[model samples]
Target chain A: MVAVYRISAIAVMVEVAIQSMSVVFGIAGQGKWIQEGGVLDKAVIEAREFVFPEVIGYLIHGLNGTILIPLTALILLVSSFFTKVPGAVKWASLVLLAVAVQITLGMSASGLPVLGALHGLNALLLLGAAFYAARLVRRSRTADQGDRLASRA
Target chain B: MGMGYAEHGGHGGQVAGGRSVTSLVADPRRPADVSVTLAAGKERFRLPSGRAFDGFTLNGGSPGPVIRATLGQLVEVRLVNGSVPDGITLHWHGVDVPNAADGVAGVTQDAVRIGEEHVYRFIADQAGTFWYHSHQMSHEQVRGGLLGALVVTPPEQPAETVDVVALVHLYDGVRTVNGNEGDVRVTVPPGKRARVRIVNTDNGPMSAWVGGASYRLVAVDGTDLNRPDPVRDTGVLVTAGGRADVEVTMPEDGSPVRVHLGGTTAVVLGSKSYDAPVVRPPATTLDLLSYGMRASLGFDPNRPDRRFDYDIGRRPGFLRGRPGLWWTVNGSIFPDVPMFVVNEGDVVRMRISNHSGDVHPMHLHGHHAVVLSRNGIPAAGSPWWVDSLNVADGESYEIAFVADNPGIWMDHCHNLPHAAEGLVAHLMYEGVTTPFMIGGTEGNEPE
Candidate 1:
């Protein structure tokens, strides 16, 4: 269970980074397309016209942020309940909270646009929280190994 | 082999032994009867209630001006592009105009670019509730308020029936009826019938119901229903890009009746200022398939000269090089989608099946089709004629129309977003070809 919790937390951390990079690449590609006189109107976006290859970055970002990262974070939360690591549940809860806030900001970014900055910042917060949860498992495992060795000696 | 625009042979250059799309016309030599020039521009305007919006407008206003014409009039509209950066074209929704006047950018004609003008001359053949909106970058342009109501009255006017147009649009996420955030009041004397033409220009189906009285759905997509029974406690679901004309007789008590539009805004009909009760939208929706008495469809759908399967599904794939869960037509993406070919006068039958987990209002430009069956169940009501038909998830609709109009026409999703998402196909006459190219120097992105 500790290993499952550790792996799920680490996956969330990795996925958050991927989501950030993919969305930024997507926006950069879109900006370049407009610079080349490719009108990036709602029609073009909805039609999902591939003005640039990096537009796939948006799909990757969206799918990972909405479905993959949140799903992995949820698994970490459930695994935290099964693990006996100290403060594992607290760190898992913080990661889940940051993910929830990040998704809310992302969904409203198109409408408000200003929320996009907060969305990016929340991704970093989520990454840090997930990393802390993953480290908790490692520290607990190391402590168990130390006790086992000491008692055997 | 790539499934991209490179595979499409419909753009630019004329096809051998085919009629040019520009050659299809409605009596070019005939003198104009009703001439109206609309200048399209990008404007920052505000509604009467002080709600501001920045978008493309016709004649400097969103929802433009109401264009009213008598039936059979030669409606000549000169569309001038003022300042819209991406250009614009007015597609007369639900008006089965001549193929040349269909106003589909890249299909029938090129986008009316800045400092350029295009003339659309068509006989107002069918009289009902219709509208015109920019077909270029339509998902953005239309949503940005580049549309208006077009009402065509029959030559012989009906007695004392007041006509009202309720064009529902969402601006910056604010739902408004005829560009008004709240109720738009119309004066209809007591016991007089008022025809409220509700146009759903949004991307989803909208439910409209009368609060103060039972109303009759007199028309659907500008086609009159045969013996439409009065409906109460039921709302009519107007598909995106479709219209419904509901006739309500004001009560003798002089109380205003609220025609609820999409449960948000409304058009109040009364003799004077009186706020009617805000009735909640009915739980039941009037099913057009069985709403009115049966009538002749004018043409037989049983014997089809051409049959096509428009199977709408979704799959993870690259559309125009962008990878996403894109909508497909007959298991193929845009530019690779089927080009339904038919000879003029061919009776065409189409089975539109949607498994895309979303509702798509399928619109066929320049033609009106009669719904024959849905999910294998035959339509038991009046011949439901529609230019825009809503096909929901898991639902299959069988529709048939005569290939009387000869030109290249767009058969695409009217939910402009879905249409942009690659749910677009083309219906072409055997010997007709378009000269316009999408996404080239013309920048014609007609969604």
Candidate 2:
């Protein structure tokens, strides 16, 4: 149980760090796009002139918002059942909802600057919640006397 | 002047000096009936010869001419077509005249046939800087040298030592000045204050700057004079068909000044200096919204008599149903549409609607109006003063101002090429009569 807890905590930290880095990189990329006359401006003059569409597609299909995030959450949730960790399923569900809301907001206000900021903010919050859940799971597992002793041995 | 026929690749050859070598100057004070012969014939035109077509202009020179007229004057022009194979018409852009006098082909009237002459007559009631060019097939006609400035001055203007009109013509990569790839240099004298009117007649948008002087913006689109807002930026971006009148108090003693435009710069110095000094604008507070608000300054809001909402956009037929193409107002082109009428001295509220996919910078010639609301919200915080407002896709703005200045005024987009693509109209003030007749001559046969 202690080993399971240690692994969960490390996974959460890595996920949070990656999410934060994504936000920073996304903002920098957005600024560059604006200087290049924004997405719409570029699309009008030269449809296939820019490479931003490829990046957007990658983020949508391959990044945390799609494959990695759900896969990670599923693994963590399965581990929760095996370890009998309380609140793990609830936290996972909340993180999933947060991601849904962020995507919805982004789609609704795709062209607006405010929406972009909000989407970034929500991603950070979701990352923080995931990390908190992992910490809780790790702490709960370590609370058991047998698990702590096994780790020490 | 004999027509020079050169076997060039294109339809016609370039003329030198843009204007005909044969000088024909008309007196503004005297009523003149001028016959203009516009033929599509091959002429031997030289580009800025030394620079290998550095000044690639039609008819041959850089800026064509300054067409001067007085307020309340009647003028007639006979347009004669001489081009090869294609018929043409001259659209008097921004001149508030009758529909028949508008000079648009296929909409208001048929194209002037080759060897045919069309007579146009209109009273100059509005005082401002306007222009005229070919309306039949604009892209080539305007790119050629068929354009000239039309300045109608008020009967009585404040006396000044120097009243200079600088028509800034910008050409893209195809043309240059003084054999330089990207430089057109202009000079202004030192130590003398001058009222300079800058007009942008380029197909594309360009920014203008005076290297060594700080100038105060006095008027926009020939109207709305308020406290000066001076910019220290490299240059002021003059969208196509936009005009800015500035008052510059030259530097002390004998400082030289240069007016730089479109990467090319020109030096105009004091009477003494052979090479003028480049004047730069000093840091100053920019008050872009201080004009046209007597109510904000403790006066009552002078409400206009009537308010109208104009849905400005393109028709489905214009771009062949190609969505998000071409700009228009109320689903019609300029010459084909009727003018929006308002009573004299009536405060008018014009709600401009933009349904086009692209953003349009709308400009009102001969008047400056305060932007009351944008997107249905009061524009109180943002700078509420502008003659040109950028109306984006699916947005609307309501602007209010008095229609005190009687005359036909042009209400159109500031983007020149877009205007060429059919985004122009007129704002007419009722009960205004002129001593002379205005518009195209009826029953006049083509030569």
Candidate 3:
């Protein structure tokens, strides 16, 4: 259970980082191709291909935060009761709270671009917190038992 | 000066020099109204201010000599390429030359090589302001001074006291008026009328105004304005690859009227001299949409047979291994952007919207269009005809035109750099095709 939680937490961090970079390209040029051309629409479409990929990026980021991160936090919470990992429960709660805040910011950014701008900035914060929490475990004898239980399940 | 219809049949196109040069031999018996010879080569010339720069010239001068003719006159031009390293072809901007004479580097003909010559024979059926420039790597060649003014006059000569062609270009960071880095003197007697034909050849629009007098806008992009009103303290913004003809009456006191071309270059008429005025745009611009007298259009622009919406935006993408912010049109990019398909005689309307936070001057080859509306407001003045239209960020323009010319024509941004950076597309007439491409082994980079 503990090993599965760490893997999901690492996946969440990687997704958040990719989302941050994709969002920047999605808004960089903003408007530069509306110039004169009879067949310009196709050229403009190709120029902005990075923008289309943004939706898929956001979906993955959403799934990582809403589904995977929560499942990781739940497993960590139940495992801490049996294990002697000090501050493990506190770290899991903070990770869950950070993921919730990150998702809210991501959802808010579509209607309010100013908030969208904030979403990118906040993603780095979420990634850093998740990275720290993912490695928070001491990897002692108790975590080994949790891992064995996780592998059996 | 009007030309009588002479049968131009069997003009031989001779192939020489193995896939590089295709020369057109004009029939000696075909009685052309005007014969002109141009030499395209490298030259080092000093501006009026004595600032020197190496540039590509059509006839050893920064702006190739003016080729003047009358409407309906057959103009024959022979282009001799004298070693420019790369190749070149003369594109008659604003003149609807026949497909063979259109001068696209690859589409119509190959680029003229070193020491090789090409002949361009076309009839100047329309009269107003137009220009000729090298279409082969035009973005660089034109800026390097490979362009010149081409004036086709009315059948009858005008009685104006003076006529001046002010082609605005930037050479080596210096603003130039007809190849002069500073004031160009145009002598016109007091009380006599003078006409100034201004061509904006830069990658952006230029503002021209009579700094100390009133002037009437006569024409734009080779189309005459109907009952143009004279206004002082105002200016006209000539888009990239666009032209504007303004007429000014000389002051009776012999005080020269300074026509400022974008703050740096100016035309000083008569004796009195004025410093180039700071080109501060007026709080309100000259609304070309409602400036001149409204005229009846032959067809209803409101009822277009085909309508296309082209919206420009930007995003990050990898173009040819270079990752950067690239432009988009209608949610797509180059090669995928709409290749507007049309047929001969189709009345097509395109609504262009720009949200890219920058200005783009749109240019269409083979035909000119009339502005129908801007931002949903119908044009209420003279039929605003344009081959190049300036579209600013956050603005939407509705333009319509009849597809009278049938061929595969390039339609792209007049801002050559933008066009090179994927803001380019083509207008394909049904049943017409091209054997040329952008990056072919036969050495063709049309932009």
Candidate 4:
């Protein structure tokens, strides 16, 4: 159970990293397309037109942010209840909360572009939370092994 | 443009030995019966409902001046681009105008840039509810308010019915009726009937229902239905870029009757100001597939001269060098999409299947098609003619149309964003070609 929880949390961290890279890659490609005299307007963006080769980054980022990350976070939260590691459930809850907020921010960023900054910020926060949650399980296992060794000594 | 369609075989192997789109126009010898000038501009305008929006406008308003003309009249519209930088072209939505007058930027004609003027001359051939919007950068311009209602009455119109144009639009996410955020009241005497023309100028389908009284869907997409029955407690789903005309009679008690648009906005018709009861939206919507009386389709769809598969699917790929999940037509992305080629007057049938996990309001310019079947079930309702048909995810539709209008017509998803996302294709008439090019110095991105 602890392994499942740890793996799920770590998976979220990896997914968040991919999401960040994908979005950055998408924007960078869009910027270059515009620089090369390709028109990038609201219509193009709304139509999700692949005017450039790097537009796949947006598709990847969108799928990871909306589906993969949320699924991984939910699994971590579910497994946290059975992990038996102290504070594992609390850390998992924080990671899930950040993900929920992250999705909301990402959805609203189009209408209110100012929210995009917070969306980026929350992604980093989610990554940190997932990393800490995964580390907690490893530290608990190590402490348990040390306790047994001390008792034997 | 640097990105060319050289790989797509340059006009789908049917480009040469064709007539130019410029020659397929209304009779230039006849003087225009109705003439109007529309100035396109981009400005921050405030609606009467106290809502402010920064968007595109036609002749100083979003839902621009209603261009009304009698049937059989030659309509001439001179479009002048005042200040919009991206350019603009007026598309006569739902009106089967001549191929040259069908204002599709880069398809029918080039986008009129700033300070430039383009004149469209076409006879108001079919008399019904229609509209006009910008085809240049339509995904943004149309949503930003570059559209208006175009109503064409019959040569001898009925004098008894009160006509109300409810040009429904969502400006910056705020739903409005005729540019107002609330109910637009039309003064109809008690017991007098009124026809509410609901123009859904949005991305998705909108549900329209009557609140206080039963209403009959008289016309859809500018084509009159064959004996449509009165609908009570049921909503009519109007596809994006589609129009629905609902006829309602005011209650003799003098209370206003509300025609709800997409559940948020409405058009209230009453003798005086009186609160109309807000009826709860019915759980079930009207099944248009088998709603009204059936009639002859003029042409048999079973024996079509040409059949095309407009299968809409989505996959991760590179389009114009942009990498992302993009909408596809026949499994090929934009510039690589199919150019449906057919001869003029040929009976064309198209099977539009959607498995893209999203709904797409497919709109075909220049011609209106009748729905033959949905998911293999033949249409049992009225002729059910439509210029735009909404195909939900996992739904398959078979539609047929007579290829009478000869030009390069755009058959694309009306969800402008989807069109931009590579969900666009052209219905090219055999031996018809356009000189206009997309993505050039003119910046003609006609979504």
Number of clashes recorded per candidate: 3, 40, 25, 17
Which model, 1 or 3, shows the larger DockQ? 1
Candidate 4 CAPRI grade: incorrect
DockQ of each: 0.06, 0.02, 0.04, 0.05
Model 4 reaches what TM-score against the true structure? 0.78
Supply the TM-score of chain A against the true chain A for every candidate structure: 0.94, 0.62, 0.58, 0.94
lDDT of 3 by residue, B174-225 (tens): 5678878667887787888888999988887777777666889989999899
Q: Provide TM-scores for the models.
A: 0.79, 0.53, 0.71, 0.78
Q: What is the TM-score of chain A in candidate 2?
A: 0.62
Task: Name model 2 segments beyond 4 Å from true.
Answer: A1-153, B1-44, B47-62, B154-160, B172-189, B224-235, B266-269, B274-287, B291-306, B310-318, B321-348, B353-357, B363-396, B400-447
Global lDDT of each candidate: 0.85, 0.53, 0.73, 0.85
* RMSD list, candidates in order: 10.1, 15.3, 11.5, 10.4
Model 2 CAPRI quality = incorrect
lDDT, candidate 3, at B109: 77
> Model 4: per-residue lDDT, tens digit, A55-112?
9999999888878888899999999999888899999999999998998898667557
**Model 2 chain B worst lDDT run, 10 consecutive residues:** B1-10
Q: By summed lDDT, which 10 consecutive residues of candidate 1 chain B come out lowest?
A: B1-10
Ranking by DockQ: 1, 4, 3, 2
